[model samples]
Target chain A: MDRPIGVMDSGVGGMTVVREITRQLPNERILYFGDISRCPYGEKDLETVRAYTIQVAEYLVAKDIKMLVIACNTATAAALEILRERLEIPVIGVIGPGARSAIQHSRNGKVLVLATSGTVKSNAYPDAIRSLNHNFEVTSQACPAFVPLVEELRYKDDIVTGIVIHQALKSHMHSDADTVILGCTHYPLLKESIRRYFDGRKAVIDSGYETAREVSSLLNYQRILRAPEGEVTHTILINGDSSRFKYILRDWLPELKYDMKEIELKV
Target chain B: MDRPIGVMDSGVGGMTVVREITRQLPNERILYFGDISRCPYGEKDLETVRAYTIQVAEYLVAKDIKMLVIACNTATAAALEILRERLEIPVIGVIGPGARSAIQHSRNGKVLVLATSGTVKSNAYPDAIRSLNHNFEVTSQACPAFVPLVEELRYKDDIVTGIVIHQALKSHMHSDADTVILGCTHYPLLKESIRRYFDGRKAVIDSGYETAREVSSLLNYQRILRAPEGEVTHTILINGDSSRFKYILRDWLPELKYDMKEIELKV
Candidate 1:
């Protein structure tokens, strides 16, 4: 019951999920792995993403994690099922949580999903939404530029970031959809611009927030929730250069006290 | 795997949860039991609520339900732990789902829970919220009149309904809490008036909605989600007169096709 949760993503984008878990379930420990060296799994082939995901999962499993969360949309689209089959712990993905959030928020029964090209190609969002209720309609758009913007920490540059977001969303801004799903983890960094694009008319969902709530529900259901009196600790493991990842970690979690280490993962 | 989910309530209040499960997971079948003869368990003692809940749960279990949902807050506060200990199938309550939702929406880390007298007395919401994060501040108010308004079908009497809601919430309207939880399943029927009382300043969370989403997440996690191609059905069983319950059912779910029956419960 005291085992730490393992969270992995292609890069620091997954820190969004980490922030939620820390804020929502403060007593539980977390082990985060960012595959920065092989970052941008969004453009990789399904087989390659699955291979990289399984490699990182195995490493975390050996270290004794109670659960596994695939924070990368592309990686989840490629590897969620296979990981659930191979791993004994509970395995969760971003797509189902995002889709469920969209379903809950949509008033017009129309949803728009914005994700990396690889996730869009996999049609995971549509499948997830339709599987819940076929009456709900889905539209997907691939934002190939969004991940790089977040990875390079250029999301804070409002002028340049605004242009990139506008270029990707302008065509769909006037669509009939009443809810937008931030299907990729990196997309949350650009949420303000996306909300502005829609002029605050539509509900914008952050998958990390929903995924964090799901984690809380599942932990409580399984009776593995850490007691509030326990001391909380966080360990972040990066498989690539640590300089930029460290910078973003500090910016996103300014008050967080955590230990960061550079680890070489065999994949 | 195709077994119907069993939902029980002290009275018709739980129809709100059934409505959500029907909307969110359209493929799954549901069997609802409303103990109308022993209605309004909110004013009853913990021992009495637990005894009544166990009697209903036993009847449902004999029918072979895959899961049991305690859709009433009072029943959940009293019998949730005991039911989990005794039942082999998964048992979920509304309190945890509501608490998680308030945590997700509260910007100031302060939440207000509006529930029945029994739920407030049990302190389940505060405990559930604090168990997840000690930083959260929870305040509970026992709205003893809210259930009567919903059950007697007087919620539509805006003048009378408005007075009752205003009297209950006027004192806490100026509090630092940024989120309001409709902790009782019956409270959602009064949502519009409650929203107006706050002047649209705070986030209002409906426990039934969050509970349905958790049900969906758990079902998916356990790989027991019914396929979309399967037919969906609903059955309502009442232990008392069905005249008013029938009227409310038609009013709340106009398009929902279902069957209703009157049954005598031993308890």
Candidate 2:
């Protein structure tokens, strides 16, 4: 299908998936929606997240999207199944790809999952990992402050950040897990800090890169890949400010030129 | 006048000013515009920032605002003059208020300015301070990474944050300056960390609060203060995702309720 692939996230975290899709399927056009207004969906109730997800999906479907990528972990956990059943297009979530990567990398059979409150509460990673291999042991930790900290760009702050990260990781450090999964996409930006905290003792897995690879394979499997062109124009829509988003994006995905557009998502 | 005052910036940095305005003028209604889509006007060239400021000013004028507040340092530096010339209503930039605060608070003549590139490059603070009293020595530093760091919420992150903050403040630490002006709104969020780093040796001035006081004075001088009401609703407009903007706003300004609307400022 020549129609654009629709991707939606609670915020910029989903850009990781978009970055991947663009790389894997160079020719495909993507319509991305970053719901920056009510982001950090990990802390919200599941019902509210599901409703928001449905609203975004419906909006994209109206735009005639060929596929849907629920780039947000919380939304995927809360609404992916219903979204797939309700929509005619294939709907993919970040969980399965992340789980698969964790399973592949876990040599000790013990895996630690770090995500937002909603994703941890949903037990999505554990469930997904177990579905693939029942023998794999999964431990989940909800880093509530991580999303906000990342959004506020506090990744490098030493004193306060050290305390927060330490508090969040204290349990995982004592756990029997040797492999850790960055369940939330936003967590990837803190990979270096997280890795340092782990001090080479554990393998840190970035689900974003793996999720991107999964998206590539899926497009190839379905034979829906777009051909690479001379110049690809990426449109970034934020319900809020696009300045910081654009800045980080330039650092994260340097190839594509970003043109930010502001849109109103109805309450 | 019944019309609300219009305040705008590139992103959440303006909230510092908005917070003060709300506190000082509880009866007044504010229409705040955070152009999250094209935020951090500090890095952009003069022409781009000027155009963006005019665009936001025009939008606010269309809403029948009584006055306009350029809550962003970059916008103020690049476009305050043009805005005052072009717009019929009173236009206020953050630089003057900040400079005034620095001057009043400083026991010693030495004052340090920490702001974005645009503000530093424009030399607005020094010029404003010198305009008041040329004898006062003004030192300005352009902290380019500070906005992004604050936006990313890196204040809590220990190692990376410490490095960035230390680097930004290194030169100012040894200076004889008794007062440091947070020339950018975003700098306030890093206040605690900044304070801890400074160890209370120098008093920090928040431009937002000072700007709010200026806005109030301007309103009183103009005789356009609105009557106090039982309920005051703030109408927020974002060119991007309204939800994301609302999420950040709710966090930034918890006391104020926002009725968000989506707008397109493509021209």
**lDDT per residue (tens digit) for residues A51-123 in model 1:** 9999999999999999998999999999999999989888889888998888877878999999988999999
Model 1 gets an lDDT of: 0.90
| Overall local distance difference test of candidate 2 | 0.79
User: How many backbone overlaps does candidate 1 show?
Assistant: 0
What lDDT tens digits, residue by residue, belong to model 2 across residues B1-267? 679989998987887888777655666788988898887788999889999889889989998999999889989899887777787898888887777667655777789899888888888889776654455889888889898886766655778778998999988777888999999988898887777788888988888876775565446434577766567777777777766556556666777876777777755
| Residue A138 accuracy (lDDT) in model 1 | 95
Task: Write the residue-wise lDDT of candidate 2 on A181-216 in tens digits.
Answer: 998888887888888888878988877666655555
Residue B195, model 2: lDDT of: 75
User: Which candidate achieves the best DockQ against the true structure?
Assistant: 1
